[model samples]
Structure formats: structure tokens, C-alpha cells
Target chain A: MSMRALTGLKPIPPSEITPREVFLDRRRFLAGATAAAAGLGTAAPALAEEMAMKLPAARNAAFSTTDAPTAKKIITGYNNFYEFGMGKSDPAASASKMSVRPWTIEIGGAVEKPRTIGIEEVMRLPLEERVYRFRCVEAWSMVAPWIGVEFNKLAALVGPTSKAKYVRFTSVVQPSVMSGVRAEVIDFPYVEGLRIDEAMHPLTILAVGLYGETLPNQNGAPVRVIVPWKYGFKSAKSIVRIDFVEDQPRSTWMKLQPSEYGFYSNVNPAVDHPRWSQARERRLPDFFASTPTLPFNGYADQVASLYAGMDLKKFF
Target chain B: MRSARAADGRFAWATSDPVRALKPLVFLLCLAPALLLVHDVLYDPEALGANPAETIEHVTGDRSMQFLLGTLAITPLRRITGWGKLIRFRRMLGLFAFFYGVLHLAAYIAFDHYFDVPAILADIVKRPFVTVGFAALVLMTPLAVTSTAGWIRRLGAQNWSRLHKAVYAIAVLGVLHYWWLVKRDLTWPMIYGAILAVLLGWRVWNETLGRQRRRPARVRARAEPGPAE
Candidate 1:
């Protein structure tokens, strides 16, 4: 096959400093410069207060790097449910219309140190960019560069108790602002959850942004989770709340149909849905008829241990 | 007499008792594009370019929805135009939709997953799009099973009609299922969404007009001197 087949038809445009960037940049600037300002300016203490409340920056910062292959998959396959109005890709297009600035993640529930953190305060953590392959159950896959913190590290800031067996995620459901939610055609207030162990997986992430910039609204701006071992939906998007639960929390898919959606939706090639086969997937960047799917989407070594003793068939 | 004679002539052409009649002919003609799509998947898989299986699945899926949407438009079209003859093809078109849906799913199984049952099951649980798409397929099963005259006769018209109304829900699911599967392009989904909106809008309009037509007659009859009430 010719490399000519892959020649660019059009280049991805450069990232712009949207209202979101300016707003976040201001917040980050304030938070980082707070120490100097405490002596020189009145703005310093407020910034310091904001920074102090942020979820622990240590672990989240360590997991922020994005490598090329993983980045490609994450960018394409991890769709923005905000875009198409519902489902995954809804965010990819519809998110572009959103004013993502002035966004704050509300962290409350069973937490000893609950706090609402601004996007800028979250970004102030050291960011690592990692490239991860994203596979959709729809039989297509993409590799993407994702930027965020390891979810375990982010969750640590809240000091999750042993009582918390699950982590529930909530997306904003504003119909007046989110016109897609107004459509009676689709159910709204999309929710997803992960078991505490799954939530704290080293591969699990609380992604802040992607492609070397703040997340595009279509890509789950503000923040989203990336659970590489599970089917893409397990990751959730446009996350607002991260409640630590004593029980396995209900996710949108499982709520829609429990017979099919299991709590542990780990990526396993061993099980097939009653309606369709799943032995192979269409690898994105396929650019043609043949790109073979990898087991565990090429993250088997990293994530396989999470599912050691479980029956994948029953769990699936 | 002349108008009646002309109507008879048109009916004869529309449904002459000969071997290849109008319904079958129109069905075949309407089915050609989808048939060509299926052929490409089976015979010329390479011709599909990037992701042949997905391209085929998409073509089959798009056509299935188009057929289902077309099938749904029949009654509303007849009501609006008073061309009740259009209802003659609803069963055929509906079956064709089922046929295409089955094929669309088959492509997913055969080409995409290579018949890996466990992996497919895991995916359905993991992916919302696949789950919805799978639900749409399951919903189609009974509709296809009951499409035949034998089953329809056995079930009776009222029960059969009620069971078949699931097609409307399926159409909505089918569109959503398709929309969810798409990566970036909005053009195709926007087209289908607009078309489905109009198709569904026509149904609502027809129902409202039907209710309005029945209301005055009911009131007037009650007002008239009659034992009917």
C-alpha cells in the first residue's frame, strides 16, 4: 500500500484561545502566582484559597502526558456525547457551541474535603499527555492523545473511604442551554459509574483536556474520565459529580437494560453480544479495508490484571 | 362512465395478474440500490475502501432506515392525499426494511467481528451505540416474524396492527442507533433526522386532523334528532 494513500487532504487547524482558554488561563495564572501576589497584591490570597481546595494535583499531574498512538484513539473514539445531542458523538459537534469557560467541577458527596474546583485550578496540576487506543463497542477504534490525571490520584484528594464501593458520575442536563436534551426523542441526564477498584485503576483518568489544549466541548470539556480497559461508555463524559457510593452505582446503559450491561464492562474478546459478533473491530486510521483489532485494545498488559478471577461472560 | 373506465385501466396496469406485477416490480426497483450494496459487501468487499465492513454496515443500515421510513410514510401519505391505494405496498416495504436490518446486522457479525460471540456480548454491554443498535435489531425480530399474511391472519388485524406499531419506535431507535455510530460527519445524520422529523410530523398532523374531523361530526350528530347517540 502506498503512503500516498495517507497524504493529508486537510490539516487539523491550530488550537485557538477561546473564551474557555482565556478564563482558565486567568484562573491558572492567579493560582500559580498567588504566593508572590500575597506579598505584592491583594489577588494572591484568593488564588491561594482556590489552589488549596483543588483535588490533589500530585497523581493527576503524573498521568497527564499524551503519546501519539494512544492520543489518536482517544481523540477520535472517545466521542463527546454533548455533540450529537445524545450518545457518544453528540458532544463532538454540539460541544463546539458551548461556552466552556467559567466552568467549575462540583466535588461533593461523601467526602471529608469536598470542594468546587475551577477548570484552571485543576489544570495547574502537572499534565502528562499519553496516547491511548479507544475502542467503541460499535466495532470501530481510534488512538488518541489524552491529557489528564490518573483517576486514582484525583480520587485520593477527596479521601475516599473504604465504605465507598462505587463512584457515580453525572453530566450537566440543562435543556435550555443544551438543546439536545429538550428532544423528547432521547433520554437525558446521562450517568455512568465504576467500581472503586475500577475507578482507581492506574489506567483510569479524570481527563481535563486533549490535543495539547483545554477540551473542546464536543470532547467533554471541564472534565471527563477515560477508563481504557472498559468499553468507552464506562468512562463517561461532561462529568459534574463524582459521588463515592457504598453500592455499585447505576450507569446509563445498565439502567436502560440490565440484562445486557454488566457492572464490569472490561474489554474482553471472549464474549459476544447476543445480537452481534465482537471478535474483531475496525481499527481507526484504517484509511482502508484492513486494520486488525488488538486484544484489550492493546492495553491488555496494563489492564488484564483487573479482571483476573471474574467470569467475563457473566460480568459482560 | 369515462372516469370510472379510466380508473379501471390504471388499476389494471398497477396490478395486472401477469407474473411480474406492480408491487413486486416496484419493490425490486426500490430495492436495487440496497441490493447493489449487499452485493458489494459479499462480492466486492475491497471496493468499500476504508472499513469495508463498516461501510457495508452503514449502507445496509441507511437503506434499512430509509425503507422503514418509507414504509411508515405510506399511511400518512394516503391520509393526506386521499390516495388509499398507497397502503398496498406497506407490508412489502416493511418486510424490506426488516430484510435490510437483518443484513446490516449480519455484516456486523460476519465481517466486523468474525462471529466472535463473547467479544460481541462484552461490547454490547460496554458500548451504548451497540446496545441501542442491538435493541433495534431485537425489536425488528417480531415485526419480521409477523410480516407474513399467515401470521397476520393468525394474530388478527387489531393485535397485528398494535404489535406492528413497534415499527415507529424502531425507526426512532434505528435513526438514533445510526447517529450514535457516526464519528464526525453531521451531514448524513442531519438529512435522516430532518426526514424522520417530517415523516413523524406527518403522522402527528394526520392524527390531529383525524381527531378534528371526528369531533364536529360527533357533536353535530348528538345535536341532531336521532337515536344514534
Candidate 2:
């Protein structure tokens, strides 16, 4: 195989790929039958089950990267959904109470066509799997296979007026349901925003599913934005509203600590966080080794032009 | 067995042999956390989850704080229970606190920064949390070194006692370091703060009462000057 193939840059055609059912069956056979046949090995079946879930290859060749996706367990289990709690593992345990069904998102503010769209209608929009690298501001990263539509499609539907320079997202804020709200850890109804061009960027997506299944609540169920070039918090989860505005919107983290979390939180290795250096990130499930972080989280080739003249250090 | 009497004429455990007998058990108890971490590193690294280095660092740091608080509680506990023997374990507990604190600092230097002194120094200078934590560790070094009987004798009881009062400042810095380190949740730090408040409050109460009791004697001494003056 070529280096590109080994690096996962080359896209395999759909027909050449193994079917999901066949793959799962092989996994089950290896887990159940092979383990028993191999004289009752203790760890084999458990390890196989732990590594069972795998998302289908990205259909959009443009979005596919040379990075392997993080383990499904790590992607689902380790999360930073502050609406549930502050601890990374708290969300997976506490987010089960969240009800995403019958959800509707209201899009308004400087948009010519203001309207409310149901979750079902949004889900029906053409979905494509995009494997993208996710970089968190806390110096951790993961490669996630997100299944969703481009934010441009959503923007096109909303019909933003010329005055709309930024797109703001708001998360669901039912304090009765979300226990983390009681603590007031952050301003409730967690808000995040993106520049109009950044929102319409081809790479920006509103993800509904991951790992070939409906998104787990801990991993932001229903719908959430995914901006590959920005910090993970910029991808607000369980979105309830999207508004187009002229002024730069205040993000939750930026509101809490303006110095630490800037509005344009693009992943820049050179701009170190006030607390620690961002030169390297600890890739999940591999705790011992930390890989050097890349500028724009290794997505600079596609998005670097957006900030051609501006200074990233000042903006960051 | 001969029994020692407290100032109030109460029998104290310091004269009993059981206090010395329990020293080994207390020593093992102090060593338990480090042993558990070593075992996890060797046999089941996954027990610490995906970030074992972080886990180790957090555990050691937390243990150091707990032991520091435990050391502070010895006086109050000994006074309340009339267990003079408790004072014997105070040095051991204090040494354990210093031991865990050093380990915590070692984990940050070795694992987190990979011994990159420049980067570590930069963090210490820039980050308030790291700054206070580093200061607390530095303050603890002298206390730990001068804890020996020889050093205490050389310094004299009054000077030794005055110098070791720095532990109170160390505890405050330690709590502040923890409080500043957390981004959102202040639950653990708040609990530590409450404990530190009570411990310090107890000392203040005792000192005030001591001053009140001594004031009358001081006034009488001034009123009736003796020939020695």
C-alpha cells in the first residue's frame, strides 16, 4: 500500500467497503466463538466488545483525513457538556435525563426567512459522514466521524440578510432537566457563535449522529455544530436556536474568562493558553504520549485564507 | 503500668505502651496511597483511566493537602481527647504531608513538563495557580528539614515554634492554589476552605482565651513590683 493509503488519505470506494452487518458479525464471531475456541481466554471477548463499534468511512472524500478516528468509547464517554456537570465523565452519567425528541430550532435575527424547523426536518436533510479532527482548548484531541449536513445548507435555508455578519447558536436550557444548571457553572443556555464566512465554510457541519448511530446524549444528541478548525467548545451541543447578527456574539467561555477564551478560538499552537502551553495535545485513550499540535489543528490548508491579514495572536 | 497525668490531673495515653505499639500501623496507613499508586502503575495502568499521569498527579496533590490538614488537626484533637500520645504522631504525619507534596511536584516536573525547566519556569511565573502552588512547596522545604530533634534543639524551643508557624501560611497557599486551579467546580476547594477555617478558628479561640487568662496576672505583676526588678 502507498503511504497515502497507510495514512488514510486515500478514499476507498463505497462498493469496495465491507457491509456493516458483515463487519459486526465477524466481530461477534471473533468475540464469542473465537474466544471460547481459544481455551476460554479471559480478556479477548471483553476487548473485542469494548472495541466493537466503528463508524462507516466518510462518504465525502474532501472531509476525510489521514488521522484514525478516536475510539468510540472515548469519544462517547469522555465529554465536556457543562449542562450536565463539570467533570469530563459527568456528562455521560447525567445526560440520560435529556429528552431530544420533538425538538425544534428557531432561526431568526437579520435573516430574511425567519422560521422554526423541527428536528425531524433537519435530520431529513442529506446526511454525509465526515471524519474530522476535534481539538479541545484543554490540550486534548480526538478524531471523530460525524454524520451531518454542512452548515452552509442550513445558512442557505435561513437566508441571512447582508447585515448578518455572525451566526449565533444557543443550547437548550431547561433547568428542571439539566442538573448542571443548578450550579450556575456557566451562563445558562450556553451560547457560541461563528463569523458568517466561518459558519458557511464547507467544513462547518451540524452533526446529528456519530459512530454510525444516533449521537449519544453525552456526545451532544439531537443536533450540534462541528467546526473542525476551532476549539471543541465552539461546537455548541443540543442546539435550540440559531440567529444571524451583525455584532460579534458573546460565547459562554469567553464571557466567563475573556482573556483565556477569545471569540475566534481557532486552534493555534503558537498562542499558548494563560494556564498552560498548547504546543502539544494528549490524544485520548493513549495517555502516555502527547503529539505536537498543528496550526489550525492541521486544517490550515483549507481555512487559513479566512484570516489572511489579521493577527491570530490578538484575535486568539 | 505507670500512668502520666495531664495538667488537669487526668490519666494520659502518653505513659501507656499502646501508643508506641500503634506507631507501625500509623506508618503503614501513611504509606498506603503511594503503594496503591505504585501497584496501579505496575499491574493495572487502566485503573487510572486514559490519563494516568494526570490521575497520579491529582491523587498525590490531593493526598498532600489531606495530610497537611491532618497535621493541623493534631493539636485540637490532642487537646479535646486529652491524648498526649497524639503529639508523638504529629511529626510523622507532617513528614508524610511533605513526602506527598514532593511527589506531586515531581509528577508535574517529570510527567507534565518532561523536565523542560524553561517551560516549567514560564508556567510558574505566568499562572497564578502554579505560582501559589510552587510557593507553598518552597515554604514546606524548611519546615520539613528543621523537623528533626537536633534542629529543634539547635534553634531553641521558642525559635523553632515560631518558625514552624509558617505551616499556617503554607496551608492557606495550598487551599488557594487548589481553588484557583479549578475552572468551574469549586466543591472540593470549598470543602478544604471550610476545614481550614475551622482549624484556624480553633487556634484563634485558644489564643484569645490564653491572652485573657494572662492579662489579669500581667496587671497584678505590674501593680506589685518585686525587689528583683
Each candidate's DockQ: 0.10, 0.34
**How many times do residue backbones clash in model 2?**
0
- Candidate that scores best on TM-score: 2
Model 1 lDDT per residue over B1-229, tens place: 1131234566434544432246558878778977787687578755664355556676788888888888988876776555677877887788888888888888876666567677567767877778888888899899988888889899999999999889888888887877876643456777877888898886775478647775565466457885765
lDDT of 1: 0.67
Question: Taking the tens digit of each residue's C-alpha lDDT, what string does model 2 give over A191-292?
Answer: 999999999999999998787866677788779999999999999999999999999999989889998999999999899988878887878765432578
* Model 2 chain A worst lDDT run, 10 consecutive residues: A48-57
Instruction: State which candidate has the highest DockQ.
Output: 2
Q: After superposition, how far is residue A96 of candidate 1 from its true place, in Å?
A: 2.0
Q: Model 2, which residues run further than 4 Å from truth?
A: A1-57, B1-15, B213-229
lDDT of 1 at A258: 75
Cα shift from native, residue A215, model 2 (Å):
0.8
